[model samples]
Target: MKTDSTDDPRTDVQTASDPCQTNRDHVEYVGMHVDDRPVVLNLTEHERLAPDRSLDLIRQSRPGFEWGDTGSGSAQLACGLLLDYTDDEAVASQHYIQFRDDVVSQLECSGPANCWHLTGDDIEAALASVTGHEALTPDGGTPTPSLPVNWSAVNRSERTVFQRRDIDHYVVLGEGTEEWLLLLCAQGDRAYPAPLDIRTVPIEEDPAPAVRELVAESNDLVEPEENA
Candidate 1:
């Protein structure tokens, strides 16, 4: 089910005084309650804004987008917005969860008839505030990391199958009974011995290729000093 200006009375026309007003270059995302269900639309595209499933490689958190609270639905919405706004999977993946908590969850609606709107600039500012980094451009030089890696710790039982130490980062591949855990850590004390990012591959598969890809794409790895 799609909602657009031509079909939805709530979004039929934009008022000149509306704060959500946008230009051709500015994309405006609108979310509202339709029959008690949430409906999101990209005002610039004039189409329904659906959640991006590709961001859910680790797990399917929710089937669609939602707002006004921090939950699986909000997480999905956050990922979708970041992906749509930045057009950069790496930037979206790195900060979507934080964006969800900082922005999406705060999009409170008064009732079923209530609505919220966010411009591309608003999203950019929110992302910057949440990540404490500069906004990402469409061509933001940060190369996309090889695969989705979770921010988690490694289990003590896992055996280190591969290890790589660089001037700034430490990467480890740990073999478990059913999976190979790939962990990237900082070189110094701030987060050393604890993974800043993690990826899991099935036990039946080889982890060497993944390790190589990750190492080659290590420029974006978070540094311990930066976090300290």
Candidate 2:
């Protein structure tokens, strides 16, 4: 999930609007609620100077099952893991224990947890880096975009760096005994607004490769615009 990269409340300049309107707006926060749970689209990055083997262990132990597979134990495990990581579940399974051990170890070494929260600037950077389609801030985040994020449709849209519209993927966060364990969604596995369902699963075989493929494909979706 992406982190809230917008202006910190401390630094935001207050404008004279109907304070009542502002107050009312406050109740309508800029996020989505999936299954009655608030889901924010923020990105964060985590780093360790030294490779943590435990993280690798947890990642490896994670079942590489796809979501929506009712007959597979791996699928169930994947769903459970997601719930564990998201703090949706009160008690984690053995797999969660192993996963938590890795996270706790990493946090102990690093001050706080951080992961890449893609912002408009990051999208711009990605567009410039990629070569075709335009990068978009479906929802604005860090370094608030000064301009609108949409672009005119052009020839060869498929070759762009980022594509317009929704995404699809299943995510695995833990191992459990039932279907409730997975994080099911149709949006990209990495972020929310990615719909929530109970049949979420890990990408088949290895999610890492699928994830990498998505990243690369994202680049391809919005490659540089052709010369006018």
Candidate 3:
């Protein structure tokens, strides 16, 4: 399973190696995290499907999307993703959908992005989990994702992730009032320091400590190295 690092919009039909054409519930979705909260993201995956490509393979969603002046280093890019949420109380549902088609699927991130399968169904599930479930705090657009959950937190049984692993970005769903969180399936790079490999379900599962810790250490997470 070859995975591109440049996170952007990408969609394709079933692959040749896929055993079942109808759905991936058996092999694709290996485990599940469930919650009864407002913006729940019950992410699941087939342990074997996580792709095996590196960061450079990722293609930009558009022209400018591919490059980086102060990019997330191959390491930072491959490091944990910031689990940010949307703050728009009155945000349109379409925005979250676009987030799926655009960033989560596009802009490449290593850790979280590597493990997720951002299909159309996953996008809808993410949206339906949130929306009008919590109070809206107008923090502008998506809230800053503070959680730096290790991108690679699964048994590498020599199996690729369900979706083509060539894709770089991961699924990051959001809801109105900016209630959202990133997911965890199994998935990173190197210049930024390696994050602690903490395992938790996507924010949808609502692990208070993990979320709080991510928020606590959010400031220390990777960013493009600064130039002098």
Candidate 4:
């Protein structure tokens, strides 16, 4: 009695020489972090996708791609992976950030030689896990409106102000009778409109340490103009 080829387990495996498998879409991605740099390869195409290509499609929040943390680098990596995997700009733009926060941030490599792998099916499943409420628009806007802050309502006294000698940028730290506020402002001149950045912390028993820390962290604050 002869056995059927259809019933053979060896026939189930796909090889590069198989004509039926040759035309199939490439779905496998391999990622590695080597020498403090990230590398991603499309195994099917036998080509590497540059991180810069992804940054070109989206505004770069970080200098480069990274994973295993919920930082700008991880976000960049997430965006790049989606764009590379789907080859759809709109799909990548709309879903990348959420995907970064959910999946990419959790990818960890314990050792230097360890590499990560992802498939088209894995990407699809991750995308599907994104809830409707977490989706962003193609333009990257959230559906909900941000509550407006009224700066005039706060009763604050200027504790100290740092002004950049070369420009109109200022970092001001203020103290209310009950709380503390920090304001970073760029005063507008003929070329541009004024923009304000504000941060606040509630008053604890002692505000000295908090004020000193805020002052230390304001890198934009430079030495004040002499005598003025």
Scored against the true structure, residue 136 in model 1 reaches a CA lDDT of: 19
Against the correct fold, how does model 1 do in TM-score?
0.52
Best prediction by TM-score: 1
Better of 3 and 4 by TM-score: 4
Minimum summed lDDT over a 10-residue window in model 3 is located at 31-40
**Residue 19's lDDT in candidate 3:** 26
Cα error of candidate 1 at position 217, Å: 32
What's the TM for model 2? 0.17
Q: Is candidate 2 or 4 superior in lDDT?
A: 4
Candidate 1 error regions (>4 Å)? 1-9, 12-19, 52-60, 110-113, 133-228
Local accuracy of candidate 4 as per-residue lDDT tens digits, 41-159: 66667677677878888754546777887766777788888988888888787777678878888876532235565667778889887645332111121122111110111222434
Return the lDDT, model 1, position 203: 49
Q: What C-alpha lDDT values do all the predictions have?
A: 0.62, 0.28, 0.27, 0.57
**Of candidates 4 and 3, the better by lDDT:** 4
lDDT of candidate 1? 0.62
Candidate 4 runs further than 4 Å off: 1-26, 110-113, 134-228
TM per prediction = 0.52, 0.17, 0.20, 0.48
lDDT-based ranking, best first? 1, 4, 2, 3
